[model samples]
Structures are given as C-alpha cells and as structure tokens.
Target: MLAQTNLPQVAHGAPYLSVVVPIYNEEESIPHLYTRLQEALDELAKPYEVLAIDDGSRDQSFHLLRELAQQDGRWRVVRFRRNFGQTAGFAAGFARARGEWVVTIDADLQNDPRDIRMLLAKAEEGFDVVSGWRAKRQDPFLNRRLPSQLANGLISWATGVRLHDYGCSLKVYRAAVVKQIELYGELHRFIPAIASWQGVEVAELPVNHEARKYGTSKYGIGRTTRVVLDLITVRFLLSYSTRPMQVFGAVGLLFSGLGGALLAYLAYIRLFMGSPLADRPLLLLAVLLVVLGVQLLGMGLLGELVTRVYYEGRQRPIYVVREELNIE
Candidate 1:
C-alpha cells in the first residue's frame, strides 16, 4: 500500500469547498494560478482551500508550491515520491480535501479558475458531477482539439454520457463523489463517465478557455491514443466488470465446445463412412480448434487467478510522513 498524504482532519471551521490542482512541470504558471484562484475564491463567498498536489515534479514547482502554501493558510501542498500522473495527483489531492464540494482543474491556465462559480452553480442544481466543457478551445487545430473531439465522441457513444468535452480538466464533483471514485492511470479523463456508471447525476456547462501564457501543452498525440484505450476500459468496467470470470469463462467454454464438436464429428465420420483420420485436412482443422480452445481456457483461468491474488492485495496504501499539516 502506498502512503497517502493526510491533510489536517476537519475539526472546526471546515471549508465549504476545495479546489484540487495537479501540477507537473508547471513552474511557470504557479504565480499567476495562485492569483487567479484567490480571486475566484474571494468571489465564492464561502470559505475554500486550494489543495495542490505536486506529482514529484522535477522542476521548481514544489518550491513555488511551498512558498504559496506558507504565504496563505488556505493553500496546502502534497508531494508524491515520483511522477504518478494526473490520476495519482488527483487521488492525493482528493484524499486530503475537506470541503463539501471539490473542484478539479489543470495546472495549465487553459482551464480558467474564474469559471469555478459556474460549476458550483450547476452543482447547486443537484448534479453530482458538473464537468466543464470548453466550447471554443484555444489549442492548435490538429494536435489537441481535433483529437479531443474524436475521443470525446467515441467515449460519449460508449459510456452514454452526452458531453461535448469529456477531456476537460475543469470539473466540480461533490466531495463525497470525489472520495468514492478510485482513480488510476489516465482515468482522470473519464471521471464523468465513471461517476455516471456509479449512479451519480452528471452534467456539463460550457466554460471559458484561454490560450497558454506560460509553458507548452502537456498533452500530445500519445495521450490521444491512451484516451481511446481508456474508453474501452471504461466500457468494459461498466457492463461486465464485476464478474470477470463470466466474460472470460464463457468465451473459453464456447471455443472449447466448438473444438470438441468438430473432433466428435470427425470421429463419427471415420467410424461410419470409413474416412481415414490420418493425414486429412479435417483432422488438421480439428487439431487447430483444440489448440485454440486450450489457449482460451488457460487465459480464462489466468484472468481469474490474477484478479483474485493481485488486485485484492492492492486495496490499502499508506505512505510514510515527512511532515503533517492541519490535522491534529
């Protein structure tokens, strides 16, 4: 189990909302980000904190985060052992969050912090997850925006969540909803899909998009491929995920039965019609079917074993502490 960062437990004066920001090599954006976030918080009329997770950034991000956290009691920082990607960063932030409503936004200024109120307003309308949709994005035509459109379309079809931008990082999920979602890999992109699968009321609102003013884009063509792959994962988990054995075992049995029936027919032909079983094309076909059937059966067994032994052991993760914050 990996040790999780602990924010001071909610004692008294608990915040009304939490904004989770995941930073990885976004050193250039911290100063501006902090100012914008503060401006947004001041307008909210509710006590809120900024929970920033430094995903083992190999840059000046941690220093800047510490400076910001020290400057304002409302800002808290969590540093990971290494680069754990956005999903892990999100987990760290969400684990330490103590707000009634939690908003997740990217470190890049592309997701305007000023739009937090829009999401909060949607949340007040009884939506569990209010995702931000960038109606007119300010990214390059080919590399970012086009691929995102294609991926979002495919995900909407697969998950039945009709949203214009599933890849948008600006989303407001109830703190309880955020705590319920278990994240890994690039699954952050599919938060709305997963939440909807868990019977959460999901909705989206168009938000402002800004051109990058600091660093280059973190995403590229590789991320687009990963998004497509994760879409398949989300669909699989939604439909037949709970019973792993059923899916693999049924396929295995189907192949095995086909193989057995073919061999039985070949045997009957050899006995009744005097068809020679040796050096025949039908016999070769039967052998191939049997081999394929065995492979599928083996795969099914392996899937069951892996699911029980490996995944079960990964349920608890605890991290050693360097320093504790806010919690008694």
Candidate 2:
C-alpha cells in the first residue's frame, strides 16, 4: 500500500478528484495549463485539487507553480530537488493524493484538461482504471507515433493488458486501484498491467491530443529502450515476484536432465559398446552442461531465499533520495 501524507483539503471538504500533473521544464506552459485545468474542473462543479509535481525543473516552472498554488487553495505543489524523471514525479504525486479518483497528465499542455470529464465518466461505469488512447495523435509518425505503436503492441503481447497508447500520460485510476500498487523505475507506463495482478477492470478511451505549444518533447527513442527494459522487470514482477524459484528451477531441471542423458549415453558406450573415453569434445560439453545446471539450481535456491526476505522481511525499499528542497 502507498503511504499517504496529510495534505490540505479544499474548502468544500475533501476533493473527489485529484489531478496529478508532472512538471519538467514546462515554464511557458504552466500558467495556461493551470488556467485550463481550473476552468474545466470548476465547470464539472466538483471539489477537486490539482497536484502539480515539480520534477526538478531548471526553469521558472517551480516558481510559477508555487505562485499559482498560493493563489488557489485547490492547487498544491510538490517540488523535488533534482529531475528524477516523470515516473518518480508521478510516484510522488500518488503518495500524497487524497481523492477518490486520481488522474495523471503531462504538463506540456498537449493533454487536454477537458478530457478529464470523459475519463471520469468512463470510470463511473465500474472500471478501476481508464486509460486515454491517442487515436488521432498529433506527432511525427516516424519519430513518435510509429515507435509508440510498436511498444504498445509489445507491451500488450507481453503483459496481456491491451491498450493502444501506453505512452499517453493522460490516464485515470480509482484511488483504491492506484494506491495498492507501488510504482518504481519506469514502470509507470505499465500501471494497467501491474494492477491487473489483482483483477482490476481497465478501460481505454480516445482522448483529444494537441501538438506541444511549449518546450521540446522530453521523450524520444532513448526512452523507448528504457521502457522495453522495464517491461522485462514488469513481466517478472507480475509472474514470479512471489515465487521466482518456479521459473529458475524449471530451467535448471531441463539443463540438468539434458546433461545427465548425454553423460549416461557416454557411460554406456564406454562400458558396454567399447567406445573411446578420451579426447572427445562430447565429454567436455557434457561436463560443462552438468556444472552449469548445478549453478542454475543453486541460483534458483538463492532466488527463493531472496524472495522470502523481500516479502516477509521487507528490508529494502525501491527509492531513497535527499533534497535541499522538499515541499507540498
């Protein structure tokens, strides 16, 4: 479970909607983004709080965010010491969110704040997570759209949680659903897949997209490699996080069985069929396979021990950082 902090509440009691925005170097877009969010959410007529996460922005984004928060009681700001990436920014927001429904969006103004109503309506139909899909994405097809499509397909195939746009930062989740899952690394992109371990209902909706009005895109082919690598870790956590020995032991047994069969055949030929016992590469291969099998089996046993400590002991955490500035 995520640890929630004591955050200020709106005048109209607790907010039903908590919008999380991750701010990078979006100094130019912050003011307009805040205005749009305020307008759209006030029209919804529900008590809402906007959680603007300042992810070590080196520009005037943090100053603008603080100024806005001081002006609007419903707006809150959290600033990190240095840029820890978007995933960490979202994690920090999730840690402090106190609404029934939590929403995540980018601060580049590309994600339309008006689309929040659509996602919330979809969630009202008993879905735990409502992911926004950019069906008509407004980006370069070769550089952005094509790679995102491929990655979405790969992630869906690997994790069995199909969605057209995993890269879309505009997504909605029930507080119950998101608070239960701990996010670290770049696994924020796989929230639906991660939450599926508990049988949560996830929905996808087409949301309006716009070209970036300010700042360069923080994403590129560089982030694609990191997402793919993190997928491997996500797959492991979903399948073997609790009992890793099952996978490792299965592989170990296969190698050991193959090696044993080869050694047995060699022994038979040497003893009964009069085959030469020396100077054959098969002998060395068999010995190496046997040794490798033993090592793998040992690794499986060690993995089991670590899993126990990870679950039972809970000795290590996923993130730790110190900062000169920490505020909310």
Candidate 3:
C-alpha cells in the first residue's frame, strides 16, 4: 500500500523518488512494466511514483498505461500529442516529476528495474547522481552492443566522466540536480557530463543488464552521429561556450598588438633609414596582425553584446524556491 502526502500548493511537492520512464513503441513491454516497477520499489523504504511519459507511440502502449495508472495511484502516465524523441519524453517527465530523487530508465526492459536499488543506495551515500554500468551487457555485440560500447568510450574520453557505460539507459539523480540542468536535443544521454559541468558529484555502479524480451531497440547508428555533435556542443557550453568573443577576441588582441608593434618598428625604419615599407615581410605580418586584432576585438564586443541581449530578453528570475528532502 502507498500513500501520497500533499504539501503547500506550489510547482512541485516533494516525494522520496520519481521514476521517469520514457516510453515509445513498446506495446509488448507495457504488460510487464508495472510488475517490474513494483518489484524494484518494494525494496526501497521510501514513497515513490512512476512518471511514465509516453512519446506518442502508435501502439497500445499509452492506452494500456492509462488503464494501469487508473488501477494504481503510484503509477501515472503522461501522453504526448505527437512523437517527440526520447529526450523530449524524458524532459517532459522530469519537468512533471515531484519527487526528491529521479530515476530514469528505458521502457524496453534492457535495463533491469531491480538495479534501481543499487543506484539509490549509491545516491544515499551522498553523490548527486549515480549511473548504472552494464559491465556484462547481455545484448549481442555485432549490432547494437559494440556501437554503444564505442560511443560510450569516446564520450567518456571527451567529457572525462569515465564510466564503463555512459550510454547505459538506467541512471538515478538527486531531484535538485535534475531540476537544475536544462535538457534538450539528444543531451539526455550526456546527463553526467552536464551535471559534472554544474559541479554535481557523479558516480557509476555495475548493474545487471538483461536482454530485451519485448519490443525493438529505438536507437541506431543515427544516434551515434547525434551524440558526437552534441558532445562538442556540451563541452563548449561548459561556460561562455556559445559566446565566441572570449576565445576569438583574446587571439585577435594578441595578434593585433604584435602587428601594431611591428608596424611601429617599420615606421621607425622608414623615417630614419628610408627603407621601403612594402619590401619588408615584417611589415606585411604587422598589417595582417592589425587586421586580425580588429577582428578579434570586434568579436569580443559582439559576444558581450549577444550575452547581454540574451539575459535581458530572458528576464530570468533571481530567486528560486528549493525544498530539502532525505537529508539530515
């Protein structure tokens, strides 16, 4: 038996944990969803709910889920009007979550729901996020498994998360960490990188991986290409990454200053010794530097302008309400 406590009326009320399952085209898997979820949460000593966001599956997945939700209060389903991608589903689930901790898993059953206890155990140890590592994944190596392994390895090197399986579908995060990060595009796969970027402590634990019993794997080689591009973007956005002037302006200034100094030397030479300015390679370098410097300076100014404009337009609120949970 489960009971939900209502707090003051606000955007979010705190619960022990919220499981965000992004479902798509998993008609065959819906039958077993509630059973596995109940099994996992049974071991946990806290109240929790399953926030299953259906990404507009054209099958009986959503309809079945709605029936399941009606049967049990702990199980809730959010249906999207159209087929937004997995990231979008996860994003919507996270946005609608009302728990102190958030656990995310794929609906295809490749990830064991029972291992959520392992992740939650790690989270209890005070880490901001705990990701599952499929050390001995049961999936075949030739097609889906090898590509995922390679991508996880490359992503680890690029972002320094260093988990055996960054692409693993199962992960648990503190609610504060989940709420703080902005997830869009395919960036849901790179949650640890973003959390680390925001100074959240992240760790990984080896968990049991099961072969899928139902439904098809939604991922393909296309996801690999998207991940590569998104990795570059994530690294850049670690700071004023989108702001171009910070990098370009510094380079431009250094080069331009050198060019100006060289030109000054050329002027001295032309004035005193009557050397032809066009004859010297140093003069040409100076001219180039000056031009580069101007470009750099312009870039810096432009970046600053863009940044200011963005903040001004956003009208971001300065104050936020944070609720504490499960902490002594």
Could you estimate the TM-score for every candidate? 0.89, 0.92, 0.79
Residue 299 lDDT, candidate 2, scale 0-100 = 88
Candidate achieving higher lDDT, 1 or 2: 2
lDDT of 1 at 142: 90
What are the lDDT scores of the predictions, listed in order?
0.81, 0.84, 0.78
For model 3, how does the per-residue alpha-carbon lDDT over 1-328 read when each residue is reduced to its tens digit? 2222332222134568889998888888877776788777867867787887778789888777766665666666777777778777777667768888899998888788999988898988999989998899887787767888888888888887777887787999888787777677788888888888668888889988888889877877767788888988777666555576877787988998899899889999899999898777887789988998998889788888887786568543221212111211
Error of 2 at 186 (Å): 1.1
What TM-score would you give candidate 1 relative to the actual structure?
A: 0.89
Best by TM-score: 2
Global fold similarity of model 3 (TM-score): 0.79
Error at 210, model 1, angstroms: 0.8
Q: Write down the RMSD of all candidates, one decimal each.
A: 5.0, 4.8, 6.7
- Superposition error at 245 for model 2 (Å): 0.6
Any runs in candidate 2 off by more than 4 Å, and if so which? Answer: 1-12, 313-328
Show model 1 residue runs off by greater than 4 Å: 1-12, 294-298, 301-328
Residue pairs that clash (backbone atoms under 3 angstroms), model 3: none
Evaluated at residue 43, the lDDT of candidate 1 is 95
The residue-by-residue lDDT of candidate 1 on 1-328, one tens digit each, is 1122333334347789988998889889988898888788789889888888887778898888876655666787887777778888788778889999999999889999889998999899999999999999999989888888888888899999889998889999998887877777688888888877668999889999999999877778888777778788888777766666677777767777877898999889888999888878877777787777777778777777876775577555332223334432
Q: Order of candidates by TM-score, top first?
A: 2, 1, 3
Off by over 4 Å in 3: 1-14, 242-244, 254-299, 309-328
